[model samples]
Target: MMKTALHSVSYAGVWPGQARLGLDDFLERTRNLGFDAVMLMAKRPHLSLLDYDADARSRLRQRLAGLGLKVACLAGYTDFCLGAERPDIPTRELQILYVRELARLARDLDCGLVRVFTGFDYANVSLDQQWGWCVTSLRECARQAADAGVNIGIQNHHDAAVHYESLFELVEEINEPNCKIMFDAWSHAPVEKAASAGFRQEGGDLVAAVKKLAPYLVHTTVADYVHRPRYRYQPNLINYICESDALRAVPLGEGFIDYKSFFKALKEIGFDGYVAYEMCSYLRGGGSEENLDGYARKFLDYLSAF
Candidate 1:
């Protein structure tokens, strides 16, 4: 990653769900990784809570300044329970309020993005209701985040509203400069008109999906993937790119993302954001800290190709 210094956020591992390391160890490790920044996955011990605040919060803040690591984004998975399956309005509103609290903490730490989501309808609700609720929610969040000078990012999760076309529509509907699609290359290829019409694979170019998405990609994250043998690539790297089912994390550049195309579009859009190296399988098998560190380094190196 020395060839390409990037501000990054890691979700595949590090500061994970129910991590036993607490905040100090997490920040200390992130600083040691030579990562300029870190994104706290705010599931538990969210740095905003003052009570029972693990000394880790204060300690992590000190370590960040001491180590010169920038807190980049506070990655949170939040919504208004707009989905029919989990329609809990009061609870989701409270969660968003909690996220705002986290944003205040992030501002104190000098981070940038508070990555959240548009509630899922990936394949469920009627497009009208889905887009309506999604647009309204994002616009409000954007207004709030803008007032706070924090950008709100909508993660492209694959449930309903986040499907390629659906998301494009949502972004267009919201039309908030503060709200943007945090393009995740691992998500589904944009649904082609032909595909939506049920004749896509017949002749539609899959690469077009990335083109369709690039327009709204205000934030970019670069990862690794390998192409299929059919592509005739060297080292078996850069073979294919696709999403993962296990933990929903894809190894960087191993699927069909077409980074060349992605990078081209990114440049066109002028995306100057975190290229989070969020690769998976790096922390499996109870690897030693040194092993994980080395693995992280190598992945970082691989990511420098862009």
Candidate 2:
């Protein structure tokens, strides 16, 4: 389908503490919230290895089928390289083997997208050496993933991080159309020229970042927002796009992000993927259904325009 879709809000936007309900409970509520599909997170609460076990695997598949929710992408977070401590042949080979195996499993699960991580640059580390390891690892991952009919979704996270240009460089050099990047809006917003429409800054814009990175835009996130006491900007339980507004982040649309063009760009690029509302809200500590439903409806309407 050329049209983009929304993953079930049941997917953890982050880790363990974020959820108030159990997995099954959340999935039911998420369906009621109107999400069309669901994207699993790469970390705890929804481990990547869940794709391997037959029982756990079968149960997940059956549940989604029963609920009519499609599996959009597996949000896995593994560093392709284990670092120079394992610079030698055997260690490196083992690392590659494990990930390749995981990629194969993801393919078997019919999850075409797997989001891996780019490690942060360390102090005193030479750019060439660090990047050399990263580049080699990603290319190998891409090759194996391609063989498995799966694509790598390189996710963005700051600190010992991979800069936007570096990510672009990696994808371009690898030259595998399937090797894509998952731009976490929080990480992505600052890296690009800030969208001039609503926010101003010497900092980069979210619009420009997404545009420059659009060719490889594998997944995107959204959320609800509200003003915070600090007041420079709102902070939700999580804000997928910014830290500057406050140490506390807000939900989608409730913050400074203008997703009109963000959604438009996906449709323009023919991204047949889910526009997940990354949970920076987590049901806002148990608010009214009217509140959650209103946000979901409004956001869905906003996205459907494109």
> Model-by-model lDDT, in order?
0.58, 0.61
Summarize candidate 1's per-residue lDDT along 69-89 as a digit string, tens digits: 776677766654454666654
lDDT of 2: 0.61
Instruction: List runs of model 1 lying over 4 Å from the truth.
Output: 1-20, 45-60, 82-89, 122-127, 189-216, 222-251, 279-291
Indicate the residue-level lDDT of 130 in model 1: 61
TM-score per candidate: 0.70, 0.72
Please give the lDDT score at residue 110 for candidate 1: 72
Q: What lDDT score is found at residue 38 in candidate 1?
A: 69
Candidate 1 accuracy as TM-score: 0.70
TM-score of 2: 0.72
